[model samples]
Target: MITNQAIEELVAKECERYELERSGFIADRQAAIRELVAQTGILPESCSLIEFAEWKERLLNDWYTRRRFAGFFHRKSEKRCMFRMVKRLLQNAVFRLRKKQTELTLDDELKMEEGRTVAFKLSSAFFEGFYKKTCCNGTLFVSPGHLETVCIDELSLLFPLKYPLLYARLTAKDNEFWEEIWRLIRRFVRFLVVDMGGKEDTEMIQEVSMETVLSVQEQMERGKLEQITSARHLLNSLQMTGRNKFREWLRTESRKREEILLSEEDWGKVEQAKEDRREVDTCGANRRFDYLLDIDEKDEYEVCCALVDVLSYGSGKVYGELVEGREKLARAMLLLYVENKPYEEVVRILYNTSDTSKLVNLRKSVSRGKEYLKKRMADLIKLYKRKGEVPFATE
Candidate 1:
């Protein structure tokens, strides 16, 4: 459990330490930032106008980390609740910075939620380590039941590593993403040195003044962010010409006028469409399967069981039959084809293997599974067709 007294004491100790080292570190950081600005000339390009420059400076100084931290932890009691507030502080700071950087006039929550969902889903889809169910509100977690080091700045680093798919999509737009990256760096430095009192420890503070902060900043300047961005761009280009692109290209080139890349918002729509179809299928399939098998469906899992029951109805109880495997294959077929997932992604997700040979074998299995499903499910298909219905409902 956490209490207001503990929080206030923490804040007081942190603020006192910050106040002691504030002047020197602030001077060092602002000088380092200005030196970088002078050297790279990136700042003036973004803030060409005098007003833009002044506004950017005001944003830097007035964005007090102490106030933000206190505003979140002033009265929080539960440790979990206090940590959640910490996460919120990180989120809100990033959201505010993004709104300022892009000048996007949309609702903050709307923008933040979309961005978070995109990051979460892309990480889950591509990275074997990232689990969507386990992530806390799209922020990175050290492990299950622990979420200590989840700053938005860390996410800025992690997203490019794991959420490259979304990064590729965003990079295609003519937006100020690089400028946002710079702002993220600045915000991270401010949060670390001033807000969080990152150097309050015993030895490191005495040994190296602000080298930790400056090293990270220097690393960022040495093309790290650009490297990450360019790598994603190259990968996306390769994917465009690779096997993944062929099916989509064939589908779209015949009818569509432009190349279609899935953006974050686009992926959100795709997931929403899946959910909507799942609901309709749950209702219709429950009714149809009940009529066919004389059993009631209680949930979506039961609906899947009903489908698997159809697959097993004619299977022999003989040896070496692989009855359960075939039933699982049938379910995978429905999820792959009926749910409209890309074959590569479905294979990647189900098998958790990126081995090219295994993927090739899985792709072949999917084709065979589809044919088997068509043959075995002819009656159900005919029933739906006669009723003028599609498997997954449109709209």
Candidate 2:
């Protein structure tokens, strides 16, 4: 409640000489402040000059906001007008929230979980091929088992001529969105490079054909990318409107188009991709799928999986081979580093010394595989920000 002393202090401080000396000019300050205190408690903290100033500003802004809408309903009784304003406020909030949701979309785990298989053919000698591919291309595999080459920087794709899959596929009304996705992918690629050593091999290293990684990808999963294309087309066909009734109706109509867009078998193929992932996540350079992870030690993959599950609404499944391979190679490399194995010996440990025949004279698959794994390790580290991933084989 407003105290007599507080009112007297404010008026006394403001009163002019004549007003101050004037007879019995007692203000109706007690009732006025007590009502204010009843409406808004006058706590000890609120009594501070700075806090009072801030509170006054908030009160004025709120008053202005309410007044703006209050004008529209003022014809109604004050109680009725207040209720009408509340309804308007709720509607306004709903519309704004819908707009925000429209700006962002929930990515399907099926899509996020599918890693596009890529192939890189090599023609140069071991060291030379290694140098070329290593310096040129990168991938952005964001989904669980699949590494979506979100960005292929400083390098170009040859086959299907579909270098950037998203560009080749995604058709969005907002051009800025495509650019933003590209930027995020580029960031992911650069992170991978920096994570892998971000450095070119000081000397010549091994190299491989695009066929190997490509074959591994195909073996890991199946189905042509026509589905991804159709899914995009279906997505594009969607109307971008905010009317609640319209949007609900659109969802129903889209399902019919989806049946036309994809057969039951196709949906099963993509949706059932988790099985392929389970098979793929098992294998890497030397280890099997389940073998790659340090089951006893909790890891970044664990964290990544948790995040994916949350993002995908708990049904997200992460699986893949080369990623498994990369993790394995990285783990082995870390072990090797600890063992103080030299470069040449490390190479022997990686591919087994028996395959030396694919040598200096010919551009062999060995070199390409080595570089691929190196790049893969780099990619994982870049994506996850976890270090000591490429463990050298110590034992």
Candidate number of the best TM-score: 1
Model-by-model lDDT, in order?
0.38, 0.32
| Local accuracy of candidate 1 as per-residue lDDT tens digits, 1-395 | 22334334533443343331232223343443443333322234343468654643343333333223223233232234334434444455445554444433222211323443332322212321222222333443321112323344454454322334444434443134333332333333343334335454422221122222233334445644455444334333332223222333234334333312233455455445334433434444422222323323333333333344343333332101323457557545545534557655766777787654454455446555644543334445445446655333122
Model 1 pairs whose backbones collide = none
TM-score of model number 1? 0.23
Q: Which consecutive 10 residues in model 1 have the weakest lDDT in total?
A: 202-211
Q: Estimate each model's TM-score.
A: 0.23, 0.15
Give candidate 2 misplaced runs (Cα > 4 Å).
Answer: 2-170, 173-176, 187-226, 229-395
Instruction: Judge candidate 1 at residue 38 and give its lDDT.
Output: 35
Cα-based lDDT at residue 379, candidate 2 = 54
Model 1: lDDT to the true structure:
0.38
Give the alpha carbon lDDT tens digit for every residue of 260-325 in model 2.
223445435534543443342223331112222332223433333322212222111222323354
Error of 2 at 166 (Å): 12
For model 2 the TM-score comes to 0.15
For all the candidates, what are their Cα RMSDs to the real structure?
A: 24.4, 29.1
